[model samples]
Target: MSENHTSTASTPSAPRKKHRNLAQGVVADISEQIQNEILKPGDKLPTESEIMRIQGVSRTVVREAISHMQAAKLVETRHGIGTFVLEPPPAQAFGIDPDTVITMRDVLAILELRISLETEAAYLAASRRNEQQLQELRAALDALLNHTPEDGDAISPDVHFHLLIAQTSGNRYFYDILHQLGTNIIPRSRINAAKMTHDDPAAYLERVNHEHEDIFNAILREDPEAARAAMRTHLSNSRERLRRIQESNEIKSSSDNTRQ
Candidate 1:
């Protein structure tokens, strides 16, 4: 025991650095490839294992990157088939990052933008929509009504419903703008306002569907004025609902702090 000695290395140990966020890095690389046209629309993405091996990332990181790309509308997954790149929207299309929208004010501002664009769109669609377009609109509405928000993300059908209206407007610009906004335009995408409206998500979604029906009916009847009014009312109601959610959240936060 008295002769015991410890050995130490002459060189100092190097500090370990944290790894980069592999998912975000993959998203950036893939998005860059798409932007550079290296991965053209309709081109199939590499298999997950291939991507993992090439990028030196885990399967989880690859999946996360794919999810982000889907949310951005850059790619779509086909069941039993590999994921494929989507055709890029026109250069004029407008895009808003979902992360930038963090408050009711932000949501209301976007709704304001929508009201300006869509009230006119509803009027134009009511007057110009053809039989096929009208049928498509109804189908989109039906999809929304049938979808269960509790079961999965309900934003796609809701966004599609509005996109169909924009397309019906016969103005390609309107459709491009909404398409550029993508699924982020759906209120549920940014906030859980549905729960604030009703404890049961189904009831809240049903109410939203009824509002949609009002707009659809107005468009179906070819009443431009009614369509405009209904669209305005629908958007205004959305803003009000989100405002209520903001207030409720504020109250809950206050109560939580008081308890603390």
Candidate 2:
């Protein structure tokens, strides 16, 4: 009997992985096109049939991939209006961060910027807030009426309170800016506040409540200068606390990465 040797070729199963990969690739391609402004906001995405034709994928795969992007807030689907890009990509939900690299000084600078905007916001809020706005502001404050330092609440209420003030300033632009920046600012401020409160509960609470009361009084009196000043003092304390935090983080990061 003669020895026989056989060589087998790879089967169609190898391409199965490629199919799933191709589906993901299609999703990414669509997302990039939209983000690049090649597909403008409010422009309807191509229909399912059209996408299938363009991507050379089956109907089910195309729909599944598009469904994933919609869930990610990158796109929205209307019953009859078709899929369109959401406006401004929802605050904190999307952005390109060129300035994500942070230094101790940069952190302090952000806090300083907050001081300027918020103080003016308080001043304008005092004289400009209308009945509805006041009601909303009070509602927001009431959400934190008795918040204790130990109680880990008031985060959302605090944010809404500031947003109300910004809106009441009668500058939609200010409101939008605050809405965008607030997402980043509030949590950092809260973390810094928690650290300070943990260190000296009584003093921290006393100072915070007193400054808040002063801001409230200024708003009630409609004294723009006092409102601004009170807000400045409040934000200044916050700025100092964050600066301390940045220094601490720098020290910690330095120690961790130190070579033995």
Candidate 3:
């Protein structure tokens, strides 16, 4: 009788790894072109061969790059129609829009919107929060205390704390909207906060902490009006900072225009 021995080595497959920057470059370059209007919405991009030639890269590289752009919703590729630029939908339309513009005015507008929606949200949350919600809020506060920097650094517990409050509000939609806004809100808030209170770290944090304490106290008391007032004060501070930044930027731009 003849017996055959099989080895696992012959069938072993190598783990696949992604190329970190090449694909990123492709996506970023294409997205920038779209945002700059070089590639408008509905404008079809060149074929794979054309891109490979222009980028001086392999077909695999081109494909991988295009895939990233598609995933970011910056472009769409049809089966036989090739890829076309995608229009940026409104904020909160879906996932991150690659074409979204970042400016001081834009940041200020977003802050204003948050002031209106989130104040009402806090009011409702104060009335509706249960013991579990209160516990979550306290936990978030603990995390903030642990993470808040004594000196000026980039660390922020703001996003997670607000997210916790939104979840504790008992409205799934509030959580969803908060999640969507998370990406856009944080950077803007950080900029505004930093610009507003760059003078004194201790003072800034004390003021912010007091605002938080007032809001939490209202929630504990189940006083919707007080909760709303606290949130309004917190967001108003943000808006005031953004206004200063916008004014500064406009002045700088005007000076540059004259110098030119």
- Which candidate has the top score in TM-score? 1
RMSD of each: 14.2, 11.6, 20.3
**TM-score, ranked from best to worst:** 1, 3, 2
lDDT of 2 by residue, 1-260 (tens): 12332222344566777777877988899889987988877788999899989999998788778788888777888988688776655455333242562555665666676688888889998988667776776666666566776786546666777788888888786677777566665444455465543567546656766777787777777788998999899879877776677777778789989953
TM-score of 1: 0.59
Q: What is the alpha-carbon lDDT for the whole of candidate 1? A: 0.84
Regions more than 4 Å wrong, model 3? 1-99, 150-156, 188-192, 195-197
lDDT of each: 0.84, 0.73, 0.73
Model 2, runs deviating above 4 Å: 1-105, 196-198, 201-203, 248-260
lDDT of 1 by residue, 135-237 (tens): 9999999998888876687777888899899999999989887775646555454447776665578877887889899999999999999999999998888
* Per-residue lDDT of model 3, residues 50-102, tens digit only: 98788776788789898888878888899988899888877854444424646
Model with the higher TM-score, candidate 1 or 2 = 1
Error of 1 at 242 (Å): 0.6
Tell how far residue 251 is off in model 1, in angstroms.
2.2
